[model samples]
Target: MNIADVDTPAVLIDLDRVEANLKRTQDYADAHGVRLRPHIKTHKLPRFAKRQIELGAIGITVQKLGEAEVMADAGIADIFLPYNILGASKLARLQALNERVTIRVTADSAETVAGLSEAFAGAEKPLEVLVECDTGMGRCGVQSPQAAVELAKVIAGSPGLSFAGLMTYPAAGKYAEAARWLAEGKRLLEEAGLPAKIISNGGTPDLWHAHEAEVATEHRPGTYIYMDRYQVEKGVATLDDCALTVIATVVSRPTETRAVIDAGSKALTSDTLGLTGFGHVLGYPGAVITSLSEEHGTIDLSASDKKPKIGEKLRIVPNHCCVVSNLFDVVNLTQGEAVVETVPVAARGRVD
Candidate 1:
């Protein structure tokens, strides 16, 4: 079926671009001698994850246990969850998942390690735990190199946990700082006779410069598979590099300078990521997605002389592709301008 025949407010992925993105990033990782563990958060499809693995990805990174479970059920043997997994109920799920796949988790504190220890205790194989370092992201991670070493020690000493190494989601443009932080942590670990097996650091913005980290043995980049407007704005990817777009039909042309599309926050996502507009209108280059309601996307066509009329369709490159993927239950897999198949988002709403 042609993409044009699909209903409005549909998610579309270009197969060619997806293949290109995968090959390019995997080749980059190969050339640098670093393991590419592409995160499945961007495209929650097992098919894509398998494709990534086929293209040379050592494993797939998932943010939640639910996503890991879905991938594991799909025959993905190696999986990594880079978030702190807590609670007895969630640990029970994690334990079950660990039995099914080679699961590795990230922890930033002794408390989290203690919890993981109890969950994987007396298991056939100890769960690998990576000490999350706060290189510069200021998110969920240990504050300093010393804290990272301390946590690594805790993991190494834990009965059911094996210390994997250091992992960090560094802030954009902070690769050097992140490298130094990880290197120091590795040094302290060595001095203390603890092995730092994997130093993983990643972000699409710093993907190309991943090798510069010098200490990272693996890189996890999610959005590189489906470049978006934010990645384009960050100069990490170009417009032609974007593989995913929201196909919306112009439902109203209230004025020459104002138009509305069927896509809204529900479809086009509300995250601007400090961008000027909601998304980049493909055909209408000058149009700005001014606002988004539940079911409508308001576009300001004041900058363009040629505005979209009622019933016209426009493909939009969203600001953040990962969040957009979570909002849809299915995505149209297209080859060029034709919709080849509609694949269910296997890990949608797997937040828990």
Candidate 2:
């Protein structure tokens, strides 16, 4: 089918742009001599994850056990669960997943590590554990480098747990600071006779700056595969680098300057991050999405000489592509203007 034949508010991925983004990121990591474990949370499709691995990614990073399970079932051998795995039910799932593949999980608490060790004791394989450090995000991680080292030591001494590395998701422009923090933690761990080989840090905004940090052995960048408005707003990627967009039809021209499309928060998500609006209109670079409802995207194009009329189609790049990917069940893989194939968002909404 042609591009115009597709339904409205459909997810479209430009394959040429995606290949370029993957090669660029993988080449950057190769030149820097660091492992690239591109996070699969951004594009939860197994085909994309396998493509990333084929393009020199050491493995894939997942945010939850459910996502990891999906990837593992799809034959992805090396997987990293960056979130702290808790609860008996989740631990049992993790244990089973560990038996299937090389699974690594993150934990910053002694209690979590102890619990995992007990749950996975003699489970046919040792679970690699990384101490999640709070470099500055103020999220779920240890407060300081020394604190991270303490947690690492606990996991190292545990029966079924092996200290794999130190992991953190620092805010943008905080790479230098996070690098120092991880270096300090590695020093302390070494001084205490504990393992601290891998220092994994991830965030789309800091992917380019990953090599600047001397201690980061592996970088996990998910959105680099499909750049979006959030990455563009943060100066991480350019508009041409963005691979995904929602194709919508201009259903109404309410005013000369404002037009409404059939794409809304349900299609593009309501994630702005204090930015302009839902997304940016392609070709009409000056046009901005001012407002959105469940099925309407209000675009402000008062100054444009080429205003879109009713029934016209417009491609909108979402503010956050990851969330947009989760909202859709399938994405039309396109090359230039031709619709190639529709790939299912296999792991969409697998957030458990």
Top model number, TM-score: 1
Measured on C-alpha atoms, candidate 1 has an lDDT of 0.92
> In order, how many clashes per candidate?
0, 0
Candidate 2 accuracy as TM-score: 0.97
Cα deviation of 180, candidate 1, in Å: 0.8
TM-score of candidate 1 against the unseen true structure: 0.98
RMSD of each: 0.9, 1.2
Summarize candidate 2's per-residue lDDT along 1-352 as a digit string, tens digits. Answer: 7788889989999889999999998888889886889888888999999999999998999988889989998999999888878888998899889988988989989888989999977776888999999888888899998898788878888998789989999865677888889889988888888857778887778888878877888888999999998888888899989999899999999888999999999999899977877898988877879899999989999756789889999988898899998999898999877899998888898878
Give candidate 1's error at residue 63 in angstroms.
0.4
Q: Candidate 2 — which pairs collide? A: none
TM-score against native, each model: 0.98, 0.97
| C-alpha positional error of residue 134 in candidate 1 after TM-score superposition, expressed in Å | 0.6
Error of 2 at 184 (Å): 0.5
- Candidate lDDT scores, in order, read 0.92, 0.88
What tens-digit string does per-residue lDDT give for candidate 1 at 133-248? Answer: 88888899999988888888889889999999989999877889889998999999899888699988887888899888888899999999999999999999999999999999
